[model samples]
Target: MAENLNPSRNMCSTNLSLLLILLISSPRPAISRTRVQFLPGFDGPLPFQLETGYYLFSYYWANDNDVRKALNVRKGSIGEWLRCNKSIPYTTEVASSLEYHLNLTTKGYRALVYSGDHDMIVPFMGTQAWIRSLNFSIVDDWRPWLVEGQVTGYTRTYANNLTFATVKGAGHIAPEFKPMECFDMFYRWISYSPL
Candidate 1:
């Protein structure tokens, strides 16, 4: 008698073999449909505030009592009020603003968000938390940023042309604390460079 042959078993085995071969042959990373490029940091003309001697004087000048008087920002006045929310209990409506930032970035507009690592008021951690909620893919992984041969802080760039940076050892007012680093960060950001 001839050996019995099951047609369904043969077909299933053949299909499974073909599927395995296909997967094995294409054992490679899938090419992305959209490519993202990232610039690490700027290596161009330095911003005015970052220039030697200027940053110190400018930072001090901006925070001087004369300027405060001219701006009518007396002690315990609107300037202080604006920095803290203790005077009035309120909720921030920044979610919509964040969405708007993402929308603008998607439309080809660049954005930069920076914070002082040591800031207790409106801390950098909170800022980072909100930024991560935007869900933008990071093109440049976080790394230390350098200025004048010294590490200023860390920086990262996103696919949506958004950059986030931190000013090391700085407070809520990054410029006031780390003026040169802040200047470099802002300069790079405005010039569409990086960091």
Candidate 2:
């Protein structure tokens, strides 16, 4: 419980800790995905600012200012992809983009990409669209586990060796929305990592 109650000034650190927890736990975690909510809303770099809530609910959080600063919240709608990577290229970029990801994923490395179904910040549908474009395939129609309840859903690509999951009642902030499942997924993904 204490671990779940961290303030936003600690959000980034919290993320780092989560990565660590996923690594340390026994039985191993099945999935791990990081949160990116427009730090500076544009800087696309570390040392991101902390000021306003990234979105509507941010105002309701105890660490609103820290969230805003660390998240780099800017004034604009996230219509499609957020372009969060600072190092991604423009030309032959698709080739450059997700290459490290593909490299790690293809060596039988497991990847878990879960989105909060209610998260407009990075919608599940959009994440799926991005996953679809990656075109990772040793085979096709690879499947993953999913619960029919409102809490979660998952789709897998055996061809690409990537799994896309959805948390039903959660929003843009997943651990905040459903910590139990978040930890569950995180623990699983971390167990057998190339990390």
Candidate 3:
């Protein structure tokens, strides 16, 4: 005797197979493209074509010359002025200071790790994750840190004398974006005041 199969089950399977085949063979929807004339960090309209599989590169002066002039370093000084070039060969390598941080914490050294909330270069989320990985107990939970009665940012403190903070409305360069807030935060931290 031939094995019996449920008719409804067979029909459902056939329908599902057809649906899958249709889905697989169907043409994908067109991808719409919009030309972005300007970007946030960039000054004016972009000069290069913005397209798929292409990256735009921008380089900013590191301001080492200004620092050298401010320090009044002699032209023929024996010690070379610090080079602020970002083109160091090993910069792309994966580097972590977690061990050093742990060492410092064990030695009872206090640390403040802050991030700009609006920073695109080194995002706050990544900074938070790095802090979390330290496995330090929270001494103080998240709270808004204020400056002159205005909430400047949020901060949290850990058991190992480590504090993490986010600067409100700041970008990659937090001090440049919010100098007063940064200064206040720094002053409070250095003075051993709660932020």
> What lDDT is reached at residue 3 by model 1?
20
Model 3 segments more than 4 A misplaced? 1-84, 88-94
Residue 10 lDDT (model 2): 37
Any residue pairs clashing in model 1, and if so which?
A: none
lDDT of 2: 0.52
Ranking by TM-score: 3, 1, 2
Candidate 1 lDDT over residue span 1-195, tens digit each = 002212333112223233334433644332222211211122343232221222222233334454455545666564422222367878896656876877899998888888899889889989989889989899999999889989899998888888889899888777766776898888887887766
lDDT of 3 by residue, 1-195 (tens): 011212333112123233334434646321222233444333466565333110111111112233334445555563432234454455445477889999999799999999999998899999999988989999999999999999889999998899999999987778756778999999999999988
Per-residue lDDT tens digits of candidate 2, residues 98-177? Answer: 77777887787777788887898888888877877777653434344443333354545445457666766778878766
Query: Number of clashes in model 2?
Result: 24
Q: In model 1, which runs have C-alpha deviations exceeding 4 angstroms?
A: 1-96
lDDT of 1: 0.62
Better candidate number, 1 or 3, judged by TM-score: 3
Error of 2 at 92 (Å): 17
Ranking by lDDT: 3, 1, 2
